[model samples]
Target: MEFGILSLIPPIIMLVLVLLTRQVLLSLGAGIVVGAFMLNSFDIVPSFNEIWKSFSQIFYVEGDLQLGSIQLLSFLILLGITTAFMTASGGSSAFGEWAIQRIRTRKGAQTMPGILGLIIFIDDYFNSLAVGQVARPLTDRYKVSRAKLAYIIDSTSAPITVVSPISSWGAYIIGLIGTIIAAQEITGYGELEAFLRMIPMNFYVFGSIFLVFLTIYRKFDIGAMRKHEEKAQNTGELVDPSKEVPGDLNNEFKATQGGKIYHLIIPILVLIVATVTTMFITGIQGTPAEEEVSILSIFANTNVNRSLFFGGLFAALSGLVLYMFLQGSKSSTGKVVLEGIKAMLPAIYILVLAWMIGTIIGSMGTGEYLADRVKEANISPTFLPFMMFIVAGFMAFATGTSWGTFGIMLPIAGEIAATLDVAMFLPSLAAVLAGSVFGDHCSPISDTTILSSTGAGSNHIDHVMTQLPYALIGALAASVGYVIFGFTTSTILSLVVTLVIVLVVVLLFQPKQNSIEK
Candidate 1:
């Protein structure tokens, strides 16, 4: 069935369906079916049989399904449970109350979300969900628009993850870089060291993060959502800021003050500590087996399953224990855990669907085909980073999945850089990561985008509508940065320059409108 031509069909059909229906899961599922059909194009009945085979391949390979579905499920479950616990323990509420008390100025309130986004850069999924979950109540308390919240959360998630060395992303990226080096039969450079070297060249990541901070500090608005933001500010009405919030609206303030601040903070701290301790014990730092362990290996190893889930679980447990000890009631602890899990349910469903679609795309060969085509184009060695960014952005935007984009582009980009004799591997890898993140940041159909909207409790369309302009601002800055690093100067210098430009531009162009009422 000419696999090349056949490969294009699924993505094309998926795109058409998505644009027409605006239903992500439906589009992805249809795409997967089409791909499977194409694989069995020679036989009608067999095509149907192949569809089941493909589905099973993704879900039941060697009885493991790679646990990809389960991991996503666990993440969602843990998110819900932890959120419930945090609320019940008064953690989320306490943080909000504290933020309200401390941030007296409007600009300060606007900037707070971005700041929090930066602090949680360890992983994109964690950053997306946690920042939104923790900051929504506070942002709402200050009458910040849900669109603004989504913008901040989405902006920070991918960019921060790309730059942070200790994140789930970092592990995947490092492994990929290592594989590329080994595949090309290159020697003399250690995997981690090579990655570290490339960080300076990863202009997009630094630029994006800079733009997010700039958006917050400068209050820039340039697109459809700008009107919404302005209207919200002028009317002083609470607009539905995020998609996660339900329509019931029985009480505006029920979840706002349900838990305490200490409950949230202590649990988060415990998670961090546990992650560090586990990393060291697991020897993720390329250290000797008998040597003293560094606190960084927990996430570096490939064997660790559900690390984020465990981290979330531990945090939730800590919150529960603290709640029980402080409130002195087992029933209270149970209620908190249950409620948190419930709050996280919607997000869980969305993530599961998103992951399934991503898995389907991989199984169908859509991602690989696209990657090979980009590679065949033979972009110039010097302009490779910028080109990689564009390719990644398109793939992620088209598919609405950053991780899938990375899975496709990273290997290709790495191999290209190796072919070009480029010594700095990290920056090239960082370019792929940055590009994937940029597209995901802006795409309405992206899972992270959905999760951010959910976490902010804003309307999904509203969040996408508002966040696009701001994301573009970051993307533009990042593109320029990528160009600089790829063609002209040092990566570190490019990062600094890009950051400055974005920050200034965003600050200079504040949105005209300021508030809205629900």
Candidate 2:
């Protein structure tokens, strides 16, 4: 059963097919079939049965209809319909027109998503989907390529969540740190302090954030991104004409003349408020009455899927009400609503396929095989963080799940550091966190990456190909910083040097371009 390196075949096959074919669903389906067959000893009937079970399990697990996947899908549907209402009512165009007057430049349009991505760090899912809806109009107006917008969204989502203790990601990571400390039983610091300490050592977090703005301000693109940006800026075509784009409703509904700016603002604000409020209520209700209720405890226990679903529901309702009020009862309210729902289908399809592939990869012991290889290697104490960064990066990229990588690698990193050198423990864990984000950013099948493209209305493959260069440089810089921290144990020195390296690399890789319009 321990397939070791053989388990790498399905994921590698998936990546190659995706890169060559540029068909996400087909690539994901092929990977799932291969992985399922491997899990079932390559038997024809059992392999297909396994695939069916995986697909069905998305709706029900443990003999109960699970809300986790269903709620997420509902939320996506609601988001789409809400946008449809906004478009039919002319709110989206009104807001874009309003923003264009004040924002003025392409840099200003690009700045909004990055800033919004940082501010909306409570959950990467909400941040990835919502920020794109809010900023896409402006970015399009300024001729910023959807690929670039997606890069910014992808950059800020997980990187910010992993670093912020107030976020869903932070709660999960802190809990893992607690387990690692208790399991190792040689801790001088508590979970919260260790989480704070690792923030600076998480060099990729800052490096990626800085690189996002650095690219925007410096006006440079790398690899395929240059072509996308130039095409957008020159011809005002925000997306690649040849490819399919998710969350693109531009051609579905036109903005009406009667719509007001507040129409767009109201639903978005409602969504944010409703989602946050639900998170608190659910988080509190889930905790036992006998236990203390605190911020971290609340976030740790919060039902993100349920909260996001309700939030989307309220937002959609608000948009619907606005449409009825502005467009009157005679207007085809159902049509606009349907268009919005239809707009999200492409993203939903891709998301569901990505989740299925993730499940099969899990069943095939892909992560375990990679982890076992890392365990067998006799890596030195000083190289612990460096090796962990590399291994975690690969694990996450192959599996397309950073959180999964964290679950598998954190405890292992703790044990390795515990045996090798206690001083390297936090650095090793930090490297795992940084490396996971870096790999996830690059992965074509990553959920956050897919949501980012959905949010940005970019072609999924275009986003993946464009973001790869920056992810590599960010990981390289973080790796260098981990090496330095392992040697000197100086957070300040390591962080400063890592950021400098990112800036230098960003500047050095300036794209060669034809005359792009200002």
Candidate 3:
């Protein structure tokens, strides 16, 4: 069952195909076939049969891997509907008009998406879609490149969620920690406290946020991003025309003449409230009414899929009602909602493909193979955190799933850290979290990355290309920070050193202000 070197072939093939062809769907499909072939001992005919068999059973109640792929697809569909409703009702325009008065400069316009993305910390999916829908108009008005907008959305989504203690990412990581603690039988350790200790040690998220700010304030652009920004400024083309542009919700909606800002604000508020409230309700679904529970317990126990689905559905329905009121036409509102769902059909296909590939990768024991390779390296305890960061990043980049990387790496890191002399556990654990985000940020097949492009209406490959250098910068700085923490074990010193490194890198790559045409 252990495929060893063969396990690495699928992801490598997928990445190569994506870079060469810039076709996500084709590349993912090819990867799945290749993985299936490998699983079937190199029988090409059976590979085709095996892939369909496994993919169809993705939602089957046979394994713990049933991630409710349909539920996630529905959540995305609902979010798309809400986004369409907002745009169609002119709520987005109203919000943009309201925001433009307070945020006049291009930098502020570009920076606000990051700020918005940061605060929408409940789920990365919501953050990516909502931030893009709200900020695209503002950014376009200022000639900010869609690539940059996509970068901000993608960066802030996973990075912010990884560090947020209340998010789905947080719950997953905490669950991983709980399993580790229980399996290792490590006494005197609480999952909450352990996760809290890793917060400052999560250097990648901090470093990524800092890099976004640097880009916003200093106008630093390197590699493809610089060219994208320059083209946007010179031609006023917010998106790169050389690449295939993804479909957006804009064309589906006819913005009303005098829509109020409440149309936008109220729906978003309802969505957030619904998501949070549903999380609590689901968290206590099985508990007795007399039983007292903590918020953390609720978060830990909540059904994330149901919460996101209901939250997005409620918001979409609310937006539909608001649009109906504003336009005074039920048919028109219904039409916009349908069109919104249509707009997201491509994204839905991409999400489904990503999930399909993810399942094949897991079935191949790809994570286990990669982790075993790292373990065989016989890395020293001091270098474990740094090495684990690289390992986790590579695993995530290859697999295009940070959660999968966490599943594969966290327990290994925790088990190894348990035997260490000092408190290396936190740093090692943080390394896994940071590295996972770094890889996911750069990966073309990543769901968040794809959704960011879809939301910003940018070219998928362009977003990946422009964002790669920035993500690499953050990853490199975080790697160095992990190394420092591995040695010094001082959170403050490590962060200071990491931030300084990031600043220096930014300054080195900082584009000339005059060249940017402020």
TM-score of each: 0.81, 0.98, 0.93
Candidate with maximal TM-score: 2
lDDT of 2 by residue, 1-518 (tens): 77777888889999999889988889999999999989989999999999998899999988899789999999999999888877778888889999999998889999999999999999999999999989987998888999999999999998999999998899999999999999999657999999998988899889999999999888768788988988887788888777788888857656678899988999999999999999999999987788799999888889999999999999999998888888543348888888888889989999888888899888878999888888888989988888999999999999999999999999999998988899899999999999899889988889999999998989999999999988988888988988897788888998999999998887777665446544
How close to the true structure is residue 176 of candidate 2, measured as C-alpha lDDT?
97
Residue 56 Cα positional deviation in candidate 3, in Å, after optimal superposition: 1.7
Candidate 1, residue 83: lDDT:
61
Residues 1-518, model 1: lDDT tens digits: 33664566666786677558756557667776776666666477886776666556545777666574566557666666666666655676688778888877666766777887888766666676667776766776766777788777887776676666777677667767778778877788877887777676666666666666665655666676666567667764446433344111213224423456877788777766654454444445545566444433445553333555576678767766776666433344455555655655655555555555555555556667778788788677777777888888877875678777877788788788878846534566777777787788766558778777766766666676677666677678878887777666586767877787777776677666443322
Candidates ranked, most accurate by TM-score first: 2, 3, 1
Would you list the clashing residue pairs of candidate 2?
A: none
Candidate 3 lDDT, tens digit per residue, 85-203? Answer: 77777787888888889997999998889899899887787688778877887898788888999998998989999988888788778878888888777776688788888888888
lDDT of 3: 0.82
CA shift at 417, candidate 2, in angstroms?
Answer: 0.5
The candidate 3 region of ten consecutive residues with least summed lDDT is: 244-253
Arrange candidates, best lDDT first: 2, 3, 1
In order, how many clashes per candidate?
36, 0, 0
Q: List the residue pairs that clash in candidate 3.
A: none
